[model samples]
Target: MVESLASPWRHDFPQLLENPQLHYLDSAATALKPSAVVEASRRVLSEDYGPIHRGLYPAAERATDAYEAARSTLHRFLGGREDDCLVFTRSATESLNLLAEGWLQSVLVPGDEVWVTTLEHHANYLPWKRVCERVGATLRVVPLNTDQTIDATQFDDLHPRVKLVAITAVSNVLGVALPVSEIAARAHAVGALVVVDAAQAIGHQRIDLATWGCDAVVASAHKMSGPTGIGVLLARRSVLECTEPLLVGGGMVDLATAEQPVWAALPSKLEAGSPNLVGAVAMAAAADYLSDAGIDRVESHVAALTHSASEALAQLRGVSVLALDAPERDHGIVSFNLDGVHPHDVGQIAGELGVAVRAGHHCCQPLMQALGVDATVRASFALYNDDTDVDALVSAVENVIDVFGVR
Candidate 1:
């Protein structure tokens, strides 16, 4: 069993302690925030709460500085260059919608197609579908192989009409880690922009926007052990310059006259209204905590747990684990369905046994339809998870399956 390195922040997260009965295996859906993140939110809400970029009071100045500092920290965390733009939104879904409506809608013309994988979450798929419908663009999917991995050869087979490729770095349901860098390079060769949904990969993997060379990427703060109601959008400045604003209000505009109007630069153009100031500060603190803990170590720990989970779960009769049977490495998500049993029932059983796992389509109905299953039980891991958690999950699953029996 691989152990996590000594991390000071590890001591600060009280939720890490096992409940002797409860095991949290749903970090992919949402993670428990550390004390630092929690205190950061409280401090923002109580100590220095005000409208940023519009006030001159001391409290407002502090709020403005903290908010912008969060931006800078995220920029650094994402390895964004000076020419990159980071837009704050409510969630990863909102960020993707902003891109589909703002950037892709304005740039992609009629008959142009957007290439996406079948493994995408609904958040990535629906927005693009809407944009394609509105702009008279086509929606083409890159089908997955029987192993539940993307067919890399399909990229070359893409139609010349393809103008943008929106993909997930790691699938929330399939747990497959997609070949995003290769896809980005190939798509760019055909003059197509790439928008990656890194919501499941951000806190678990090292994402270098420069190396990934995508046009834009989105992630939610809550999945990264931060606060909710705040998501991040990272894009190339040139690409960001070509997009329109989704929301028009407060600080996003530079000058507004009845006859003529001008919007602010890159980021401000995309970020409208008061913004999630407290969420941003807390997210930045969470990012800092992850950075200090060493993302590589954190990733390794979670990967180990997931790998162990696959092995242990497979030992149980009438159980099947996706991606593990394949030769490819999967992300932290482990999705499965027991024979002759509903996923919701399995989830309920596990929950009663003190294992918190996600049930249902996991917000990926399209993918779920493709898989020929209505729902799946998914157990995802995080840095705080250890082998004991994996053992607990395996034990809980065995108990659950025994009650239902194999079909």
Candidate 2:
């Protein structure tokens, strides 16, 4: 058994302690919430429930204050400027769609090109694809290297007609970090705007919009131990000022005449209706918890777990660990396949043994096709996981091989 790199802060999460036998390795899908986040959410739902930005009552005022405060917290957490507009959405998918419909559709024209990578999740890929189709623009792809990371050298293939580049900071399936800063610099040289899908990277790495030099970034709250139904889109102030709102309704309009309606300011104009106030508060608490724990320490801890688990799994016969021969650059995700066993069956068997993992294409069918596999079993680590969880996962896979007789 590998020595325990037990998380000192694991006790902060009540869900992990609630079921001692359960080994949750599916954090890439959604993280288990910490007690602070849960308590914060409960407090909001129980005491401060009210419609925001519409009333002068104490409860309404408190709700609006808390909601906007949450935005401020996230902005600082992400290293965003105070003037930047952070729009709240249901998920990263909605954030990308908003940019597609609100920003890209207005700017793109026939014969223009957009570049995306093979490592993108469907949320990042499909939006650009649809936008390009609608505007008669061409969607180009940056192929992946043999190790499954983005081939940065191929970025020169970006034609002068390329108007935008949409890419992920990390691959959801392979966990390899891409050179977003380099890509952004290259794309900017060609006068193309860069949009980053940071859903998988936000929880594992420190995000600084200024350092990346990208025009926009989108990430989800749930993946970082926050509440569901809340996500953030941080864009440059200039970009938000010019990009139109995807959804227009109450709370987003400043003035509405018979023929013309003036939209509200930066953040509110993008936020179409009553926002997920409770979710925002909980997500803020989550961000505070991560910050207090030190994101660098959390990242280092998870990376160690990933390396240990990947090395162990690679030693097992009939288990093909993806990117095992390549230099280690994964965050915390380790995807693999058991010979002759389908990924879903592998996941089901692991679940029966109290080991939770994710199976299937992981919302990246294009990536799956590029990998030449229909699906993969992914065991993703988080701040709450330890060596015991890795042992449990390896034991479960051993049981799977025994049951299937895969030599």
> Cα RMSD (Å) per model?
2.1, 1.2
Q: How many residue pairs clash (N, CA or C atoms closer than 3 angstroms) in each of the candidate models, in the order given?
A: 0, 0
| Candidate 2 local Cα displacement, residue 362, angstroms | 0.3
Residue by residue across 1-407, what tens digits does model 2's lDDT show?
Answer: 98778988778888778888989999999999989998998999999888889889999999999998999999888878756778898888989999898888988999999999988999999999999998999998777788777756778766678999999887888888888888888899899999999899887788888889888899999999998899999988888888788888989998977478999988899999888899889889988999998999999999999999998998888999987765645688999999999999999999999999999999999888888999999999999999999999999999999999999
| Candidate 1 Cα errors over 4 Å, as ranges | 1-10, 17-20
lDDT of model number 1: 0.84
**Predictions in order: lDDT:** 0.84, 0.89
Give the runs in model 2 whose Cα sits over 4 Å from its true position.
none
Give the winner by lDDT: 2
User: Which digits, one per residue and each the tens of the lDDT, describe model 1 over residues 1-407?
Assistant: 33433333445676765354557889999988788888888999999899888888998899999999999999888878778888889999999998888888887789899999888998999999998998898999888788888855669866567889999989888677887788888888888889899899987888778888888888999999998899999888898788888899877788987566799886887888887899899999999988988998888777777888887787788787766665555568899888888889889988988889999999988788888889888999887766767877888888877898774
